[model samples]
Target chain A: MDRPTNQKAWFLVLPVLLLVAFSAVIPLMTVVNYSVQDTFGNNEFFWAGTAWFEEILHSQRFHEALARNLIFSAIILAIQIPLGIVVALSMPRKGIGVSICLVLMALPLLIPWNVVGTIWQVFGRVDIGLLGHTLEAIGIDYNYVRDPLDAWFTIILMDVWHWTSLVALLCYAGLVSIPEAYYQAARIDGASRWAVFRYIQLPKMNRVLLIAVLLRFMDSFMIYTEPFVVTGGGPGNSTTFLSIDLVKMAVGQFDLGPAAAMSIVYFLVVLLFSWIFYTVMTNFERGGQ
Target chain B: MNFAWMAWTAPTAIFFATIFLILVGMGVWEYARPGGAPRVGILRFETTRGDRLFVSLLGSAFICLAWLGLVGPNLWWALGLSLVYAVLVFRWV
Candidate 1:
């Protein structure tokens, strides 16, 4: 498993390094520039120091958006992870059904984000949409456009439909990778299904589950397009998660300085959470080992 | 079952077409240059060119989505971010 220390490997890395630099580093630098400087029309900018950053940090708007984002992510993780695990467990482990099931499960993940939003938007309309019409027929008031709870329900459902497959797929891969010998040992021990899963399967799937959780958390935290397209962050800013609020600031209102500062803070928060998740998970893994 | 309304405007169609073409081109490239001996990057696992391609493409799509959602409909920033994502995927993923 020891790799030879070959400097020539840098040649292999050069292409990717250049590509990342061109894309990520440059724009990030621009954000940094905007964060510290004040800009007027005609591209004129003046030094603003940390005024924008301080303002954004102290702003109630930012706090509300951040709170919404945290709550949404928490809800998504709670629902998706357990639901995905259950789905993965129930999926056919052997036979042609396996491939068919996997492909069907993966369909949602491949749809473009905007397209998903559009689909949900149309699907949730009270008049034309099936669910909305059915709910109304059943004597349940269901209007995502007007009701904040309904809007949240629709958005959460849309996310669950779009992303649960990812968690399921990851867990399925982990499940499939479990060695047959482990199952055989469990059988020899006359272990119950729950016992087998708890001790053998769950432990085996830990790494992939961590990946699924981390991905879901970060993605749900940064989510914007699907909800935006569906709700426009409306019903009175009720659904305005941090990304949506950030977009409104940077794009809608053209508040560059504060937006840039907020962007930096947002990026840092995401990085911090991801780092914490990774560190804690990896530490737990090492401790178990 | 009518599908005609799904037709995209010229710019959107062209952009998506180009992405599809690039993915096809990558497939062709892979066929031409077979197994890219797996190498370790930032992650502990060794990845081949195909894995790198998957990561880059997915990452690029995310970059574009985030850009459109957060920075406005203007795509120049998204393209820049995607290019960086592709490089990072190749370099590290």
Candidate 2:
């Protein structure tokens, strides 16, 4: 029961293409234009021809920022995925408790990024902050402002607290979609919980899990506001991820050429990784099917 | 519309224009031959022509950037390397 291939349906997509061209294409083109050129002041430019790219590529600063960003994203994915799944699995399947759990999960995600940062900043303070006060009372020294390790820990903790719920909600959606008939069959066969989860639940959740992973990865990689407000890329640059560094270059220093080159490289890195993730996940899905 | 605010130069403009042309050409090719049958090559991943094009482009970017970083900004040899890589990808990947 196949319908006719209507070429006219493409007309519906025209507006979206135009919108994308204006929003994404033009800005990207401008970035590309700046990447290959140098500037001093007064809009005067020189055709630097990948010089900025070379400089940025060879720069230790860029390398460090990129490394930090990668590590942060990796840590986030590692913690959030399993934790989210566990939380989702433990969530009530029926009754008023489901609504309560969903609202709780949604609460963290609903907070603005800057507000989340502010909340954590005050919450981690030694004098007034409950977390800092508790740590001090326990005789464990915890100061995000002075200690690099503590700063990193706080940022990671903040991210986990904020974003884990998104993964939980997605996984919960996947979990709830499982037909009761499957569970009945499993029960009749006296299948263990582990077997049921592995054979049915895990497989069913793969698609949503993939989405959760990609979203979390991209968001964490591009993260700026929360970390910026909390650590300001300090405890001596331990927390200065790529986005913060890019802002420092572009706005703070007015080094547009190098910044643009770095931006292009950064965008490419994200695109390449996301593409790889998509390909691998889709291949896995095909295998599962 | 006056476009001097963007400060576009000839070489960068040409580079972008060339990329645009290539993309347009790829679109035309796709329209001409509707089904880009996915083929498993030496890479052992099932990839269509568009996927190969994307891989080639992404790989070429890294190659050019690496060459520029390691060697120097003189990109002629890098361009040659990229073209060879693209050819190999189209042929085998």
Candidate 3:
């Protein structure tokens, strides 16, 4: 459906632009300003072009954090995408069950990020937490605070529980939007379930699935609060993802220059991935058309 | 669970209650009017009232969360960001 060309739409967009400018653009510019200049108390700054960026690029800490971030995002995508699709497939497609499932699934997504972290943090404590006590009772020594592997496991599980519903919800919407006539045709042709899913449901869900992947990837890549609260990037820096490391630099140590540069790099990486995903998905969407 | 409400401070309780109220208000509105059919926005496609509400609420939540995470505990920033987000959702999304 082609919308009428209307220049007046700029009026509608102006407010958002102003909002983004104040909220995102200004703060980003401050980071950029800090990235290029060195400051030593009393509001004094010296020009140090690209030095901070160079330092960040060469830092072992930055490399480790970046690697951890990439690995975490990859693992999250690997698990969540297929799992979400399967969950969506199993969900009831009709009646009150649909609404109930949707609402229940949406519950986690509605919780504040820090609250999610806190919940998991308490829940994973070895002494009092249910998960910790249960694991201990079963004779598995599970201590997220003390063990690197345990921390990773807890963080990943928490993320999967929190976010899989988003992917499932998007897929469910896609699945429901599929016309009934398509299923009728498939039944008449005696298509197998896998055959039907592959040709009909999968193809139909492509757009929404792409959206789910992009959203999940970007979010997991930038995740901070939950993991920070859960492990505080502890157990020997094992959970120190890029965002946490950046925060430690920017906030903890007040190393503005490197932190600003790191923030820019992080932003660029997310932007690059999102762009790549968008391009690839749109290409596929166009090809299908 | 008996004293679950006791665990919450006044502000947290109020914040959560407000969110609940907004959701309940939306439910009532939807039931009363019964029309959330898609309409063209700034996006090149049609979106329903439910879509707009979801976008607004989710975006606002993120804004609020990010504000708390990145900035200090000031809610003024969150409120300002939410207003902008709501306008954008109603206008474009």
The stretch of ten residues in a row with the least summed lDDT in candidate 1 chain A is A1-10
Native contacts retained, all candidates in order: 0.00, 0.54, 0.00
**Tens digit per residue, CA lDDT, model 2, A1-289:** 2333666887899999999998998888888888888888898888888789989999999999999999999999999999999999999999999999999999999999999999999999999999988998999999999999999999999999999999999999999999999999999999999999998899999999999989999999999999999999998999999999999999999999999999999999998889888888877877887
TM-score of each: 0.74, 0.96, 0.73
Best by lDDT: 2
RMSD to native for every prediction?
Answer: 12.8, 1.8, 14.7
CAPRI accuracy category, model 1: incorrect
Q: In model 3, state the lDDT of residue B68.
A: 49
Per-residue lDDT of candidate 3, residues A87-130 (tens digit): 99999988999889989999999999999999999999888999
Q: Report interface Cα RMSD per prediction.
A: 15.0, 3.6, 16.7
Candidate 3 collision pairs: none
The DockQ assigned to candidate 2 is 0.52
Model 1 spans with C-alpha error above 4 angstroms: A1-5, B1-93
Cα miss at B29, model 1 (Å)? 39
C-alpha lDDT (0 to 100) for residue A14 of candidate 3: 93
Compare the candidates by DockQ and give the number of the best one.
Answer: 2
Error of 3 at A83 (Å): 1.2
